[model samples]
Target: MGERSDGDVVLAACDLVVAGIDGPGVSALAGVSLRRPWDEIQPLLGDALLELGLDHHEHNSNEGKALGLRLMARRTLAGELSARELAAWVHDRFGHGLPAAEELARLDDEYDILEYDDRATTDVDEQVMAEVRRITS
Candidate 1:
């Protein structure tokens, strides 16, 4: 793969965070309440970036890109994009050839299951649930 844009790296990092939270088995966000604090989540983001081969030395040296990624993550956590939307973004950017795209597809399935379970118990907004259903179904 060519060099990923800063924005692409940040979005991938966001995907990693969501996947870590919602993937099967135990997770840090598993028993948490509705509001997930960034402090608790930021480390996971850093780990995700590292796993994707982002160099810590480069990240530390490039303060601007690092700050941009942080802002992007904040926006992601703030619900600027829904799970489906994020998946689509990754799909469009990376296509099916990349490992990250495949992993994102798997994560999309996990997201669907979690959303289904959440919708079963709580009164999740109909529009949001419907969109998720439409995308996942």
Candidate 2:
């Protein structure tokens, strides 16, 4: 739970490179632009959105469509690609196409409750997990 290094994150700009996307702090980053500051890579991120076929209006592109958003949702939730840092960026660019930072925070909060609630199963948490799976799937 220490602070991650710059290469620890699988950023939107680094979507082309899948080395460290398995989780937070998972990738050495090999050869990617993640080492650069976010401002320098913002344009690359915009290209990623376009490459995925996602627009400012829609979540999925026509090529694979559902797959990219699903990857984004699941990887973020798993702490791989990450969402917290890019929430504002994603919102400012993609709008409803991707989850905003607030939604990501809500999901994280619900996930934390699921981990420690001591219930056999909370219906709400199950629903949230289901949503996570649905989006990821």
Candidate 3:
């Protein structure tokens, strides 16, 4: 996590769907321990932005709204890095469509956050996990 002089760094992964894949699209914030120095994670953020296969075309379907990575870095009192600063950085980097990530809540299972909000959340996750296991096995 990018610990800013601010506080605990929080990250929400961008929803990913392989462009032409008909089944088993992947989505979730797989847990990661980002204990690297800010200098390291900073540039890595750019690389992550580049890897999001989202389509931004106005004519694109609902997927066009998929966000790039939400970088959550806490700034220290030395004030070298702060969450407030990350807000502006996120906007400038990912465009206005992306949220500043200022209001995210913590969750124990957040790494498995589902993209779907409907009643099928459990079903979707189970199906995807099953598909993954089947392929990998």
Candidate 3 lDDT at 56 equals 31
Q: lDDT values of the candidates?
A: 0.43, 0.43, 0.32
Per-residue lDDT over 22-120 for candidate 3, one digit per residue giving the tens place of the 0 to 100 score:
222222221224453333433343334344554333322223322322212322123453423433443444444433332221111222354444434
What's the residue-level lDDT of 73 in candidate 3?
34
Model 1, 1-137: lDDT tens per residue? Answer: 12354444445444555776333212333332234443344344454445556544333244433333334334444678654555555455444544424544445445457655644422323333343444343
Clashes of 2: 1
Runs of candidate 1 with Cα error greater than 4 angstroms are 1-74, 107-137
True-structure lDDT of candidate 3: 0.32
Query: What is the TM-score ranking, best to worst?
Result: 2, 1, 3
List candidate 3 stretches off by more than 4 Å.
Answer: 1-71, 74-80, 99-137
Candidates sorted on lDDT, descending:
1, 2, 3
Candidate 3: 10-residue stretch with minimal lDDT = 102-111
